[model samples]
Target: MSSYADLLKTPGVARIIAAQLTARFPNGMLSLAYLLHVERATGSYGAAGLVLAATSVGQAIAGPLTSRWMGRWGMRPVLSLTLVVCVLSMAGIAFLPLEVWGYMAIGFVGGLATPPVQPAVRTIYPKMVTSRQLTPLFSLDASAQEIIWVAAPVVTTFIATQISTVLAIVVAMVFMVGGGAWFIASPEVGRVRIPRSKRAFGVVLRRPPVLLSTVVGFLLIGACAAVEAAVVATFGHGGPESGIVLAIFAIGSLAGGLALGHIPVGPWAMTRRMLIVFIGMAGVVFWLDFWWLSVWLLIAGIGIAPALAVMFAIVSSSVKFSDTAEAYGWVGTGQLIGAALGSAVAGFLIDGYGATGGYLTAAAIALLGVIVSAVFKRAHPDLRGRDASPIPDTEPVPVQPS
Candidate 1:
């Protein structure tokens, strides 16, 4: 196999991605499914909206709780648990005749049990490839997620149209089971704990780079989620093709992330130039509510994966290998919290002001990321190009010379 394809053969990396693809494939269909069930059973958008809120709550809380499991029992057990929970959740929704409340309950449980794939992918990346090769690899992962998000929904939608939605969900469940079992068989994932006796929360929380990175992730994810909700609401009812603009928006992000992820940059790369990226990325988002929404969004989306990969690489590089799970978990949690906040707020804002309100609100929130990055540069003159994470096993990260 070629070097790029070789990632698929890597024991741990391959399995982790497989599990991610499996566990998350159905996520694309979730919004549509909620709409279908709620409208079908309760005959009102109000009840459907309420159920979607419950799902968001479940997903938001799931990150932290699962983080604890990943910290304690390690990836294998957590991966297993995620698969089981995902499978069971799908089954309940599939086999049972659900009332509106029942649908809400299932959606909540399903969201809560969703796997923390991005963090897992990050923790294993440094191990899967050389330090220098990490960026492109992460970019590929980001790109793959967008591709999956696009494809999965189309596939599920087709199946539901042809056969039944339940059958489509069952297909998603099979992918999870098959992929989860395969991941467990990998050699690299284990429960070995690295030495860190200090409080994990205190040490990680106080670190400045971590704080900055978490803040940026929070703002970016919020903007993305808000856009997602807004697009769904705004372009809704156009036709069967009405919802496709989201796929286009995501494709833009995927393209941008791929460019950023795969192309190698010089050292201290993101520190000096991030502001330009921040402004441009946030600005294009403001008017992304029209026929041209997808095009601008594509431009806006391009900066995301690259910038995010840079921050995540920096975060991983700064922490001890032992704390990778929790550190990434915290960042993930912040992003999730932001997404949750953005989604919740979009409903209120859109209802009051209009669909355009959502676009403006999301952009304004993302601008905070630009402000935070600027403040970081001003306050910390001494902290440039610093990958704070100590290399593991007392073996210095040679490329880093740390």
Candidate 2:
């Protein structure tokens, strides 16, 4: 496996990664920015929550379609058109004085047009580097994503509170447009086109490994969302302290991803590690003191990126190359759905029983992921430490010349 430094040295890899990161940074900010903006304008958290829900619903609905479009129409055209619509919709939400219905409509449109940057980049990764470098590359990618999650909220909150909520949203929109444009224009993205899959849309998700990964991803992300809500509830909202606590969780994930390169392990080792950490986190939640809670969160956080990296590796190895982008889209949708469920459920629990209920909810969700993994172990050949080869059943589509 190549070291992180060596991976970046691969021609054109670093540029795409940078552009992808910029395009995705807005993801971390969008929900919070919307929440603040709507709540302030309408004086109703209910309205704000509804708008956020619309955005998630829109993204979940649009994700697979967008990925398929990328395959058929090519990255540049799909991304170019979507980026334009996304920026405009975001501007509408920020600047328009319409009622909650208008905000919901605009938010949905923005999410529907959310740039397919992550899936596009992941689809291009195998073409950029040798098979041996994949694990490290994925680990580095996962780790870098933590930085976006850590920093984006801080920046968004500062601008929204210090300057204006409208400006905060505009800033996020600018990054999305600038980054999406640069990514679409990249030489590598322009040179290669993913040949369209002949199978019906969503068929790729029928494969057991892909389905399993999507379900597990949902559970894991849901747990993270619950934990976030609990942490914020622990320290009341609208303070800098909660942000620092969340950053600690991300830092733990970063440390774990970086450490994964040094450990020589079989294919599903990361999954097992994730399960163990989740169990530990559940047990530690009983402590409940601020410092103790933070310690447990940090420990649980260690498993997050590693688990995601391994899931991506498994999905990559399990499906035909043509199915790659759509497979990732399904996984992304699972995550979005999970986060929504987690927050909604955790909010109810916390309101009724306090932070303890939130912790318990997270633990239960993690255990559900474990159960699913165990039951489907046979279905996931890659998880069994089998030879890391692409599934032989499907023929790979060659990259079409532009």
Which structure among the candidates has the greatest lDDT? 2
Model 1 residue runs over 4 Å out of place are 1-19, 190-203, 240-242, 262-291, 378-390, 393-402
Weakest lDDT window of 10 consecutive positions for candidate 1: 393-402
Could you report the Cα RMSD, in angstroms, for every candidate shown? 5.0, 2.2
lDDT digits (tens) for residues 1-402 of candidate 2: 348888999999899889899989999999989999999999999999999999999999878789889878888889898899999999999999989999999999988998888888888887788777776777788888998999999999999988999999999988898888788888878776777788799999888878988999899999999988988887887566778878988998888888774343354564585686586569756777767877777888888888887777778888876778888899999999999999899999999999888888888888888778777776555433342334432555555453
lDDT tens digits, residue span 21-60, model 1: 6656666666666555456567888888778778777876
TM-score of each: 0.81, 0.94
Give the Å shift of residue 322 in candidate 1. Answer: 1.7
Q: List the residue pairs that clash in candidate 2.
A: none
Candidate 1: the clashing residue pairs are 256-302, 317-389, 318-388, 318-389, 319-389
- Candidate 1 TM-score over all chains jointly: 0.81
